[model samples]
Target: MEIYIVGGAVRDRLLNLPVKDRDWVVVGATPEQMLAEGYRPVGKDFPVFLHPDTHEEYALARTERKVGKGYHGFTFHTSPEVTLEEDLARRDLTVNAIAEASDGSLIDPYDGQADLKAGMLRHVGEAFVEDPVRILRLARFAARFDFAVAPETMTLMRRMVDEGEADALVAERVWQELAKGLMESKPSRMLLVLRECGALARILPEVDALFGVPQRADYHPEIDCGDHTLRVLDYAASQGQPLTVRFAALGHDLGKARTPRDILPRHIGHEIRGIEPLSELCRRLRVPSDCRDLAHITLVHHTKVHQAFELRPATVLKLFKECDALRRPDRFRLMLDACLADARGRLHFEEAPYPQKAYLESLLAAAAQVDAGAVAAACDDKSSIPAAIDAARTDAIVNAREYWQRDN
Candidate 1:
């Protein structure tokens, strides 16, 4: 049996990216052959096996056809007769179509290496429309690689969205891709691409409504709400932060649209309103309950950091207690990063001649020290630690030490 390593592992290796996971494609290998060779069958939809020793995934070379709608409507075809080039040609993006033989030689039937070097994302062949998910996948890939989508592919994506092919996508799959993109190094770019192509409205009509919604120039001065959100995403991604942080950054201002505008630039309780929409979004997208809960908490707490900055110790502890009671640190940090990203996106801060970055750094450093459980307990006690909250600052060193201790 001849085996070849394929897909993301090979693509990432060529790009000098860290290979997070590896998948192999075995050609001319039957399930019987795999069993004979001590490989275990594991896939229900296709011929996939687990290596006996390394426990890595090994799948037989396969092809797919669209039998219906949505991401899951495809039927896979696998046989010893399918050529590597034919399999690669069916991929969604050129950059992901590269393969490596067992000897570590590269296979580039569609010039994936050239496109990778060019920082471009292109569709492998005309069969791109067979699956609607490619539109989101292309956008998500662009976020990951920070690469530009080829003009032709962009045109195809636009056509697909315009033709209602995007509507065939389920909310869960769309959310899956969106969450991954927001977790990437350039989420805003992906969002803008989606916005430009009209897929944003299909999944997040609430966010789409923020497009061109006026924000007062005195404070915002960054074009509009949509532009401001994009800035936050760009800033968050630039920091190389974690997934939740980046997600919070992209979603921090999502409440602004629901905020009352009777007064100029007014968004009183917008954060509160934001929680429902964000939660509904997560539900619609079929996100895991834990992640959805975090996203909801992130939305609710977006305004807390700024509000807590000047609180009395009792009040601060009470606030901390409330968040701690929820006991979701991942969600809290996600909100904090989102808030920080929004603050950094202000026109004044973006062009500042001052050390705004340093100030933010100091704030994050100080805020890190407050324990979520301690704050939750304090808030639950109803005994205001207003003084402590007012004086509280995150002690980065202490927090880091604590983190290390927990791991140990």
Candidate 2:
């Protein structure tokens, strides 16, 4: 008759991490009994309900079986006889399997607390392979915890990928898991894990192709495109930017891999070419429209912003006009950092032509805060708002005054 908080909320609480979500396991309860208790039924395939007073999720102990293919293909069984231990055992990673009993006692049926203490991520049971979604889940767990996956668990994941089990994963589930991983404290490890398990090839062949592609010795002498990408990912993590920006940082140079080396030492217009593919890639992966727009801005403005030193006021304004609505300042900043990181990692960059820090800083400052609507309003004026000219002293004064008063 006791209801105990369980799953991620409990695990996160034990780790001293923020417990953002809460769920409970109701022992000695049946679906009919829960309904009679005023809990609203929610899970069509399992005995999950919402508590009447708390509105928190409450599920009767349940077990599931693979009914068919893909992540949705599961048959769940629930009964009053099922124990909490049985439910925890079916979870993907051990660190997430521990539950908190109603008395605030730690429940470690799978030794998940030990794994958590040891900074490891282990599969709950052999039943892990019952769903291919677990592979991405395991990778995401590593990103979130900065923990390494156990070797045997990785072996199981690789087998899942090689056995065609991963093919059953739908685009939506794959992207959802990947976006979550991308938002983690660090995503480089996630990519590394994905690549090691052959999941990257299935998810993004273009990025996988970057693995061994050689850049001209004059520009890149350290490693192939892929290794440099990993360094960029590391930089993105170090900078601690948000997920959308991080995705842009990871994808910024992806088109370089698709360019022909016959052009040698140069991949002209690669930025333009990269955009279409990147857009399609995001769409196919089910990236949210808002995030996809940020990715687009990174691809378009990356090269344009680099050339800002040579740009006329009109051109610069046009660039901002094109991107101002995207609300991706963080993405743009990460793109600059990634580009700089890539350059520093390449041997040829030591002596190659590079923008002076002063000039780059000035350009970045100009781009820092753009008034998209004001610029558009100015553009529409027939009277003589000079295109992309410096903000007039009068306009600057009025804007600053408005901002100050608004804040006050």
Candidate 3:
């Protein structure tokens, strides 16, 4: 068997990036031969094995044919006759189609090196349209590598979307790709690329509706709600925030998309309006509870967070209770981070000071000092326990706010 290093490991090394995983393609090999050589079978659908020594993935060079619709509707053909070139041809992007021989010599029959040098994301062949997941992968690559998608590949992607391939995607698959893209360094690219190909509207219509919608220029100097959202998402990614924080930043302003045009850009009750769409988006995607809860909290209460300095201590304490700050301080902190990102997401405000984050965090900390157990014990009656605890926490919040104001 002639084994060659292929896919992302080869592509990343060519671009001077740190290679995280290595996949090997075994040319002129059968599953019987692989088993005879001590490799362990691992692939469920096709011939894939784990190297006995390195434990890296090794798949027999295979070609795929489209047999039906969506991502799972593919038939993979593997045999000793399948050439490495044929296997490479089935890849999604030209830049990912290159392979490396055992002698370290490069193989670039599809000119993946050329496209890599040009920083282009081009489809390997017309077969790219067969898999709907390629569009999500391409968009994710755009976010990760900061590459420009080739016009022809984009055309193919648009065709896939228009042909209802996007609709074939299951909820978990979309979330899987979206969550990965959110963790990338430039997550906004993923959404923008999807938006360009019309898949964003197909999968995430709430986010898509935000693109052309206008925001008040005075507050959001970027003017477009979509632009501002991207800025917020990029900011969160830049700060190395976790997926929950980044997603909260993303969905924080969905209500603005529902703003009545009759009121122009005011969006007087947009925070309240945001509840339904964001909830529906989370439910439809089957999003994880951590991400869903934080996104919702960020959407409903981010405005309250921004106005923290203006509100009374009772309102501030109410914010802490509503966010469950005492019980889940970590999530509460993530909520603050998303709100902080939102505050800095406007034009000419990328580095603007958002004292609101620190301010709210301090208030939460102050309220958390309340000894709930002791307060519960001191309560004369069972139902009065919650009220007593709230009263104590409010007093603590008042003192903490006074100290913060005095110190600042």
Query: Best-fitting candidate, measured by lDDT?
Result: 3
Query: Residue 223 lDDT in model 3?
Result: 92
lDDT of 2 at 56: 86
Query: Roughly what TM-score does model 3 have, to 2 decimal places?
Result: 0.98
Clashing pairs in 2: none
Candidate 1, 264-303: lDDT as tens digits: 3766777787877777676677766655655565567656
Cα RMSD (angstroms) for every candidate in the order listed: 6.9, 6.3, 1.0
**TM of each candidate vs. truth:** 0.79, 0.80, 0.98
lDDT of 3 by residue, 1-408 (tens): 799999999999988989999999999999999999999999999989999999999999999999999889999999999999999999999899999998999999999999988989999999999989889999999999999999998998999999999999988899999999999999999999999999999989999999888878899989999999999999999999999999999999999999988996777898989999999999999999999999998999999999989999888878887888888999989999999899999999999999988888888888888889999998789999988988999999889989999999
Candidate 1 — which residues are off by over 4 angstroms? 259-269, 288-304, 307-334, 348-408
Query: Lowest-scoring 10 consecutive residues by lDDT in candidate 2?
Result: 356-365
Q: How many residue pairs clash (N, CA or C atoms closer than 3 angstroms) in each of the candidate models, in the order given?
A: 20, 0, 0
Question: For each candidate, what is the lDDT?
Answer: 0.73, 0.72, 0.93
- Between 2 and 3, whose TM-score is larger? 3
Question: Which wins on lDDT, candidate 1 or candidate 3?
Answer: 3
Lowest-lDDT window of 10 residues in candidate 1?
353-362
